[model samples]
Target: MPLYKTITPNSQTTVKIWKITESFDVLMEEVDLKPKSLERVLGMKSELHQRGFLSVRCLLKAFGYDDVDLHYDENGKPYLKDGKHISITHSFNFSAVIISDSKIGIDIEKQRSKISIIANKFIDYEFSYLDENALNYINKLTIIWCIKESLYKLFATPGLSFKQHCLVIPMSDNEQETVAWIDYEAQKSRYNIHFLEFEGFTCAYAIN
Candidate 1:
């Protein structure tokens, strides 16, 4: 079993990510998943999905909880029956989860070259002032994607466009926190977004 590294942003919240080099079978064995969760895990063809579940389960266990007791809401958002707040995300070979005593969201993505091809689809004026340097641009794009993705997960709105609803504030690379706002019908609100880089990957989280 791979040891999970956890970052404590404060007393009420925790962020964790698992580097997915572990064999899928090993990770599956380490988690105490429920019958339905096991069935869903078996059904996932993408390593991303498996790693996400594995990481989420491990995070829950670290806090002395079990994934078996949790379920997803109508929008496919995972929720603990006891009302504990949680969010999960996965990309390529990495998976992450954020849990807090308050509402929370989290996302992770493997830094990739392909993001440039689809930049217009999700970015907008909110990022207009970002540094134009090549390295900085790539980093900002990844961070924006992660930030929007986190907001989308938190809102659980299926058709919300990242360019339209999720906004990332322009900031220097030295900043660890950003703001994300979602104005979809019935879900209009703002969240405190945070970003971090590790091992060539980027992660973002939003807390309400």
Candidate 2:
């Protein structure tokens, strides 16, 4: 049980992160997966993805739920059977989940310089505040990417463009939280964005 960290962001919300170091067989032995999840895991070609999937079940167990308590919508957004809002993310050796009484979303991403290559596709308004020459440029870009991804999971709306519709308010590296807005199809909504970095990975969650 490599439960890396846990945070109670609010009275109603819980976030759990897992550091994946177990073998696929070890994780499989620790968790009892629902049939669909078992099938999904079996279908994954990459062992890393298989481990990531199993690690999520591990996180669920830590959160007092299990694979049976989770499901996905038509948009592929995760939901909790108990009526609590849920969002999930996994990258490389890390996986996380955020569950709240209110609608919420979460994302974890590995900090990588490759994000710079695709920055234009996902960033628009944020470019004004970002300094490409800064030493923390990759870190900043990872945060923005995670922010947009979390927002996307929360919105769960098809055809939502990260570059055009989601706008992350500027914030310094020292800031723990900020705000973001989604303007799409004449509908507008706001979210409180919270982020943290650990082991060279960035985790961001959005609360509506």
Candidate 3:
């Protein structure tokens, strides 16, 4: 098991990251998946996606939980049988999970320049501090996207627009943590957000 890193941000929240190197068959044999999960992974056309799916189960196993203990709501949000909040994400060769006593979200993404093309789609207020010509523009954009994506998972509210509702406060250079907000439907909520970069991938998590 390539459990890359583990973070205990607070007494109630834990984050785990895994670097995927196992073949689909290897991962398939390692995790005991539910019938529905088995069918879902087997149906994935992309081998990368298949392995990512199974790697999550492998992470669950490491956390002392099984596929049987995990359930999804109609909104597709993940939950544990004991009621701990859980969020998951995978990008390319990395997958991550954040479980907490309170609501939380986690996301991982490859830091690619291509993210700049769609920056406007999910970014709005952050533009006030962004520099398109900066050397770290792509890295910054990727972080913003990951942050908003995590917020989406944490909030799990329909009709929330990343560009309009999620806002990542200004992040300074070399800063690994920041704050974010969800301003929608006359309600405003705040969260503490953290992020890290490793092997060209960015991982971000939001916790309340």
Give the number of the best model, judged by lDDT.
Answer: 3
Q: How much lDDT does candidate 2 score?
A: 0.94
Which ten contiguous residues of candidate 3 have the minimum total lDDT?
111-120
lDDT of 3: 0.95
Per-residue lDDT for 6-123 in model 2, tens only?
Answer: 9998999999999999999999999999888899999999999999999999999998998999998887888989999999999999999998999898999999899999999999
- lDDT digits (tens) for residues 1-208 of candidate 1: 4444688888998887777677778777778888888888889898767776786687677767898767788888988887888898877777777888988888888788788788889988655676555666787888899888888887776889899877777766688996778877676798998889988899999888
Q: How accurate locally is residue 38 in candidate 3, as Cα lDDT from 0 to 100?
A: 87
CA lDDT of each candidate?
Answer: 0.80, 0.94, 0.95
How far is 16's C-alpha from truth in model 1 (Å)?
1.7
TM-score attained by model 1: 0.89
Tens-digit per-residue lDDT, 11-82, candidate 3: 999999999999998898889999999899889899999999999999999899999999999999999999
Query: Which candidate number maximizes TM-score?
Result: 3
Error of 3 at 196 (Å): 0.3
TM-score of each: 0.89, 0.98, 0.99
Ranking by TM-score: 3, 2, 1
Error of 3 at 75 (Å): 0.5
